[model samples]
Target: MNSLKRIMVGLDLSEMDETLIRYTAFLCSISEIERVYFIHAEKSLDIPDEVLESMPNGMPADEKLRASLIEKVESYFGPDSRVQVDVQVVEGSPLKELLHWSKVKQIDLILAGRKFHMRGSGVLAQKLLRTGRVSVLFVPENIEPRLNHIVVSVDFSEYSLMALDRILDSALTRPEVRITCMHAYEVPTGYITLGISYEDFDERMKGFARNKFAQVLERFPELNDRATLHLVKQENEDDIGELVMVEAKRLKADMLVIGAKGKSAAALFVLGSVTEKILRYNDDVPMIVYKKENEEIGFLDALLGND
Candidate 1:
């Protein structure tokens, strides 16, 4: 009876496919996720008209290839599985197809693998992170499963509040899951008076931020028993992305969660830079970018097509 009824996992048909399936199965087992969708995207072949005319009206090799991939996915994740599973193969862009499928089917979560190399820009991943309605779980390869340390970055924004609530409501709230709520603040340059004696503005700001954290904690009583707070000071004038990276390393956190935003007024149409930078640069740790909306721009929209 878990609320996350449908879970979608994007498959690349790579060596890590099995691991992705195993992780998805593990999640479904824990959350009682009712449906699991396995999606793979393929490009349509450019065969000459003469070649098509010569072929008989029978199953093509591409179809067989798609079938084999689906079978492999189902065999690994669907065997003796209580959760209902469906395999889908679609033509066109991978990210776009995945988002379209998610929206059309109303998926509750999207599970995707994180690449270590800069094979291609993660436009689809970024889009899904920013505007997708469901929660996203980005799993890094070779990460040993452990819930020992969980880091949730808070900006005191409504989006961060929603992300924190979702984490607590999900598997993260378990007694064994060690949770750290982090907030990083940067000191303004003018705060230091040149003529007068050094003011205690930094101390006052820290106290104010602590009070804000306290207010958020009061709104969620469930976290009181399972969560611990950590306040960070960013004296280097780095952005939120840098702050999160520093905090993740300092805490040796197993998972990082952040809220996504749009970039510019017009380009600000999708997920913001913080989430994208983490996904691109930080491959050592797995990150989850939670979204408030159901609609998301696909990978192809951002990378393949020009604006």
Candidate 2:
């Protein structure tokens, strides 16, 4: 993603819709986003008796929904606006429409509401983030948006590198903001077979991860303090996600950024277990999940039938 100019937001007509729109407006201003599409999908645009009595006869449901969304967006946007806004109401599954429209519209980023103790657990937004081609930013229902400091979960993979690059190159990396490159490493259980002590191997792992981070710094010489390294040891297979979140909370990070890294669609998970666990456990601090730029597209992505 070269820039966050064109973006999209998915609305489900719930209380989350307002939050999503408001967050999107805030993002557009900070990022200098040129165009934004606010879309809502419905399985069926059929009107019931209550809606029918409120509207004129023969008024289409999609148009009515579009008008409602326009009003909501206008309330948030200023009159002297440089951003172009379009409200669309489409039929069929929300997930498919989000993915399809993201590709068709060439969206750079996606913004959606991340509900905590709200009506839903924000699973649909997570699934959409996992399945789409574009990057997704999940905003909570009740948090002030800020990008002063970002914690990026780096595994030294190309995807993580891409994410860090995009974040630094984008508007989020202001002079006042800080970026943390955190890597969690685990010592192999089979190290005993090599006559290596646990403490020694753990030290070696830390050194190795630090060396990799140093290589990254060498490669990007311009990133003086724009990026810094933080190493964490994984105590268990399933705790890396929690460790990342807790560390982010510890660092008082405004956002947690991670890139999806995996192979073909047939693989068990292209998003990886750590990313999945993070999505499930994260209840605070907005996260932006970046999809692999050059992924092997396959049949499994257009999945679950709904959003």
Candidate 3:
């Protein structure tokens, strides 16, 4: 579990983007966040002819836009602030610029606002999860910046283990935090398609789930004393994503954490089907999508090879 020291927030100058900045401010008040960077990436370096003509001779359009965006971001924090704030305006696609900044600044966490209904924004969000290395926090509209109850989606994979580690690390620092480790299992569709007994099939799946849960408890003994485990069984007719959301709501979870496996040749980027689907339907709950540390090695590791 790594505590965030530096955070890079994506700023799109939208209403939801303000929510992200406000959420970051809340973290600064509660945690040990030392620095914040609000970055906006402009797609083109070239300014519109109308705007360029209005500016004084020899004045660069990019510089002027950067100054304006910085001022707008600064107003969110006001004059007095404990955390150091930096405003950046870069020219390129949002995904590329944000990814490069995260690596260069060694950002521990990346924050951005999300509205699932917006297709363009949704695409950019997926790009961040797929391509970016830093852990991402997608804050929905009207999210409280509080983590009273957290639901962590697990599947016993190393990616889920990484998510569990980060969630537990944060939970340890906060007393009386309610943590639920949720594992959703599904029955094979072939059983239902072939008209097999639903009850018998369900029972067999439950037996396997029980054994898996036991193994999970053994791997994370801390949960025995600190957290509760929730087992979910999904039949062929049930949507895994909907089931996850329902369980989280039943527990009244304030946040959800899940792991993302980085890009592979076949899939490009893998956060698993369930995790991505949950992201699609999510509206208000703040979700943290953490990537495995060793999955995509940096330049140094690539150079070193298997030593």
- For TM-score, the strongest prediction is 2
Worst 10 residues of 3 by lDDT: 298-307
Locate the minimum summed-lDDT window of 10 residues in model 1: 294-303
TM-score rank order: 2, 1, 3
Winner by lDDT: 2
Better of 1 and 2 by lDDT: 2
Clashes of each: 6, 0, 0
TM-score of 3: 0.80
Q: Candidate 1 lDDT, tens digit per residue, 1-307?
A: 2446787888766655666787776666556577889887766644354544533445464455456666776765656778888887678677667867877788877888776643444455555665445678887765666566789888888888877877766664467778888888766676655443224667766788889878887998767777777888876656666667877878999888876543332554644466775666567677777776533344324543435
| Pairs with backbone N, CA or C atoms under 3 Å apart (clashes), candidate 2 | none
Per-model TM against the reference: 0.81, 0.89, 0.80
Tens-place lDDT per residue, model 2, 1-307, is: 4377888999987788888888788777777688999999898888675864654456688877777778889998867778999889999888788887887788888888888777855677876766665788888888776778889999999989888877776676667888889898899998899999999999999999989998989877756667789888888655776888888899898899988764445664455577787877777788988876546345434453333
Q: What lDDT is reached at residue 192 by model 2?
A: 97
User: Superposing every Cα of model 3 onto the true structure, what RMSD results?
Assistant: 4.7
**Candidate 3 local lDDT, 128-200, one digit each (tens):** 7766567898888677677677888988788898788776664223656677888887777678787778788
Off by over 4 Å in 1: 45-63, 118-123, 130-134, 193-199, 237-239, 262-265, 269-272, 294-307
